[model samples]
Target: MKASAFMYGLITGSVTAAVTILYSTPQSGSEIRSSIKNASTDMKHKLYDVKGKISDLKDSITHMTKEVKELVPEAVHDIKGSIEQWQLSTEKNKLRLEKEISAIQTSLAELEQTIAAQQK
Candidate 1:
């Protein structure tokens, strides 16, 4: 008897819940279906647009990497040539400065000798 009572209560509760759901819904079944379909279509278009943008980005990155690989070697070669040229130019100036310093030392020595002779 207790089991039969429990079963009856369950059925009654299920039927009342169904009727409440059917009457309380704001949109009809057809309108809900249409809205869902439109939403799915919009989502697909957005996904395709995102996919195209990613492909374009990948292509641009690949092109830039290729350009950097080509330019790096050329830039390094130019820098090496510039350094060698600078060293060559400075070598001539260094020799001339050394000669000038030696000449100045000799002149000072001769002046000191003349002053000592005059004192004597």
Candidate 2:
């Protein structure tokens, strides 16, 4: 008899608590479930969008790398050619300057000898 009384009290307490909780809730169960579903769907869409942007960024990087690979050798070859042309031009200028310096030295020696002869 004591066990039966204890079970009855437990059942009544459980029902009362459940009723209180259902009545005190703000939104209905369906509304909360729908909101959760919509939020999940929105998250999925955003995830897909981010993945697509990452793929595009990867493709852009790959294309830029290929272009750099092609251009670097060409740029190096052009620079080498320019250096060679500059060396050739400076060689010619060096020869011409040497000739002019020799001519100036010869004129100075002639003037020095003429002055000495006049003094004597």
Candidate 3:
């Protein structure tokens, strides 16, 4: 339970006790009546104050949730972009390596042909 709820419980218990005292004794009736209005009004203000604080806390949580929801998708898109760039780079390097290997093979064939001609 919330602290405000607990405070309300305590206040209600006190009011009950005060009423009990008022009925049990004659002098207590005048004293209880004198303070009852003030006590009830004070409790009303505390309740409204607690209610306002709760509303503010709820708004803050909702805002934070929205921010997190917005950020997560953006973060995922950014990671995907990085992965795509890395793949393109890897493909470019692979093609360059394949071209180099093909050229080396052609050079070796030419050298072998020259060696065979010389021997003939």
Candidate 4:
């Protein structure tokens, strides 16, 4: 049982008990009938209002779910593309750095050979 339904039942039970007590007391029949009619009308209106709110909430949730579904795939695709570009650029930079290091090593070896020849 839903919490709202349980609470409504509790309230209805309490109201029924109260009304029964009032009816048993020395009140006019006309007044008792009028009270019962008013209570019934109020209960019906409250139930209708609750139903309307639940329907609106359901609609709002459905709309939000659809919007999220539409956006998530596009967002994932954009992120994947960005990561691939970054990886490609990093690989290119690594290759360039390696070439620079090799050039520096070759220059050092040539300089060492020139110094040895000069010493001789």
Compose the digit string of candidate 1's lDDT tens values, residues 4-118: 9999999999999868976787989888679779989999999999999999999999999999999999999999999999999999998999999999999999999999999
lDDT: the better of candidates 1 and 2: 2
Over 1-120, each residue of candidate 4 has an lDDT whose tens digit, in order, gives 899999999999999998789868776878877988999999999999999999999999999999999999999999999999999989988999999999999999999999999999
Candidate 2 accuracy as lDDT: 0.94
The whole-model C-alpha lDDT of candidate 4 against the native structure comes to: 0.95
Question: RMSD of candidate 4 to the true fold?
Answer: 6.9
TM match of model 1 to true structure: 0.57
Off by over 4 Å in 1: 1-25, 98-120
lDDT of each residue in 33-114, candidate 3, tens digit only: 7788789899999999999999999999999999999999999999999999999989989999999999999999999999
Query: Each prediction's TM-score against the native?
Result: 0.57, 0.56, 0.48, 0.56
lDDT of 2 by residue, 1-120 (tens): 699999999999999987897678797999867877898999999999999999999999999999999999999999999999999989989999999999999999999999999999
Q: How accurate is candidate 3 locally (lDDT)?
A: 0.93
Please list the Cα RMSD from the true structure of every candidate, rounded to 1 decimal place.
13.9, 16.1, 9.5, 6.9
Off by over 4 Å in 3: 1-19, 24-28, 82-120
lDDT of 1 at 35: 78
- What ranking of all candidate models by TM-score puts the best one first? 1, 2, 4, 3
